[model samples]
Target: MNLGDLAYPDVPTDAVHLLPLGATEPHGPHGPLSTDTIISVGICERAAERLEGEIPVLVLPAVAYGVTRYGSAFAGAVSISEETLRSLVGEIAEAVGALVLVNSHFEPEQVETLRSTGLPLLDLTRRRNAERLTEEFRAGSCHAGRYETSLVLAERPELVHADRMTALEERRVDMPAAIRAGRTDFVAMGMEQAYCGAPGEASAEEGSETFETLATMLVELIREVAA
Candidate 1:
């Protein structure tokens, strides 16, 4: 169940509360700025639906801004300070005792900030989890590539500009490698158009499959924490 749809009296205090975390950042010319948030909320919604029959589940309204330093050069790349993000999430977690964070924004600062919250998280950035994702994702070139673009296509096709996506050529940059080398921003990392990877290869079918995998992973994390 979605927490936003319920009244205070109908709220289940004992339910497993999922808080989807993401960022308002530029995805590309083809994708919407809310891509990260949409992907995160989609995973939380799917996980909640799958777990509701087995246990009480509440998908909280997503936190749609994060520590998005990399995309700051791009338009609409709104970000909050790490301290602000940590405090905001920490406050919410305190109010909702049984909380699990479902985050899709993979900026290193964002990931580290969430990790500081000490709550259970569906962190796909971890090697074990990253290995389970699509090839483009694991290659670290999936900023607005097939992996993320496909996800947006599946969750909100109307938001994806098909013409722009099809017209863009593949731009492959090893993001993880660049990060290791101390590249701080998207442009510095060679993402001139504020995107990387292969947008032309995205497909909604692949997105649906990827969502299932992401939801399953979230479900597993919730089960471990809720146990």
Candidate 2:
């Protein structure tokens, strides 16, 4: 159930609250800046539907911003301190006992910040389904690439700027090593164009299938945990 659609009395105070977290950052030239949020919400929606009558699940309003300092290039990226993110998540979880987290942003720092929440966080980025997609998408660069672009196509096709696909496939950079090497921005990591991976190969069908796989994985996890 959507929290916004319910009155205070109708709110499921005792239900399991699920929170989707995303980053308002650059998602390459072909994808939307809100790609992360779109994917997060999409997964949450599917998971909720799968568990409809089985569990009391409440889909909370998505957190539109996150700790993604790595995408500081080509505009649209915003970030907050790790402490700030932690506190914000903590405050939300405090009110509902615990908030099950679902996130689409894969930046190392952002993932670290979310993990630091000390709450139950189900990160799909590193899951088996995502691992397989990484092979197909060559997503080691960890930015707007085939995987993310396809996800956007599945969630919001109109948001995709198809005219800008594959312009920087050859310039894809390895972000994790760059961060470890003391580099601070996307420009330093070789993402001068603000995206990586084979976005040109992304298709809505691939995206839709990937989403179903992820949602299935999430539902199974929630069932295991809830059991």
TM-score against native, each model: 0.98, 0.91
What are the Cα lDDT values of the candidates? 0.92, 0.78
- Candidate 1, position 140, lDDT: 91
lDDT per residue for candidate 2 within 108-138, as digits (tens), equals 7778888887677777556564664546443
**Highest TM-score: which candidate?**
1
lDDT of 1 by residue, 1-227 (tens): 99999989999878989999989999988999999999999999998889877878899889999989898888888989999999999999888889999888999999999998888989999999999999999999999899999999999999999999999999989999999999999999999888899999999999999999999999898889888
Q: What is the lDDT of residue 92 in candidate 1?
A: 95
**Model 2, runs deviating above 4 Å:** 125-132, 136-139, 166-170
Q: Worst ten-residue run, lDDT, model 2?
A: 130-139
Model 1 residue runs over 4 Å out of place are: none
- Model 1: pairs clashing at backbone N, Cα or C within 3 Å: none
TM-score of 1: 0.98
